[model samples]
Target: MQVIINGEVHDLEGQILLSELLERLDLKPGRIAIERNLEIVPKANWASTTISDGDRIEIVHFVGGG
Candidate 1:
């Protein structure tokens, strides 16, 4: 399956949950927000949200600045 992430196309072996995708990307759940197909997905729903082919995902990271 293929999904568009932050404007880039990524190919995956099969369907996976949003949380799993984050883990595969080495992202810390606490430090990021997810937008799926133009909708904001709450952190509480990540584990239950199943990502499918053609899904568009946007991961926004929180950065600490001085």
Candidate 2:
């Protein structure tokens, strides 16, 4: 499957949930925000949200810096 994430296109395999995608990418659950298909997906719903082909995902991670 192909999806757009943060303005880039990514090709992924099989049906995958948001949480699983994050885990596969090694992203910390508490450190990021996600928007799917122009809608904000709550952190709690990430586990239940399924990512499909052509879906647009925006992942914003918090960073501490000056």
Candidate 3:
């Protein structure tokens, strides 16, 4: 599947759920926010939200600084 994440194009194989995608990216679900195709997907729904071809995703991760 070809999807655009954070403005970059990615060729990911097979059907991937939102939660699975995060795992593949080595991202902790609790530390990030995801917007898929202009919709804000709730963390609890990540497991069910599926990523399809041409989907646009925006990811924002929280960071702490001293």
Top candidate (TM-score): 1
Please give the distance, in angstroms, between residue 40's alpha carbon in candidate 2 and its true position after superposition. Answer: 0.5
Looking at candidate 1, what is the lDDT of residue 34? Answer: 91
User: lDDT by residue for model 1 over 1-66, one digit each (tens)?
Assistant: 999999999998877999999899988887688999999999999999999899999999867788
Residue 63, candidate 1: how far off, in angstroms? 4.5
Please give the CA lDDT of all the candidate structures.
0.92, 0.92, 0.92
lDDT of 3 by residue, 15-58 (tens): 99999998998887676789999999999999998899999999
User: Which ranges in model 1 have alpha carbons more than 4 Å from their true place?
Assistant: 63-66
Each model's TM-score? 0.89, 0.88, 0.88
lDDT of 2 at 31: 66
Q: Which ten residues in a row have the lowest lDDT in candidate 3?
A: 24-33
Candidate 3: misplaced stretches above 4 Å? Answer: 63-66
* Candidate 2 local lDDT, 1-66, one digit each (tens): 999999999999999999999998888887678999999999999989999999999999767878
Clashes of 1: 0
On TM-score, the stronger of 1 and 3 is 1
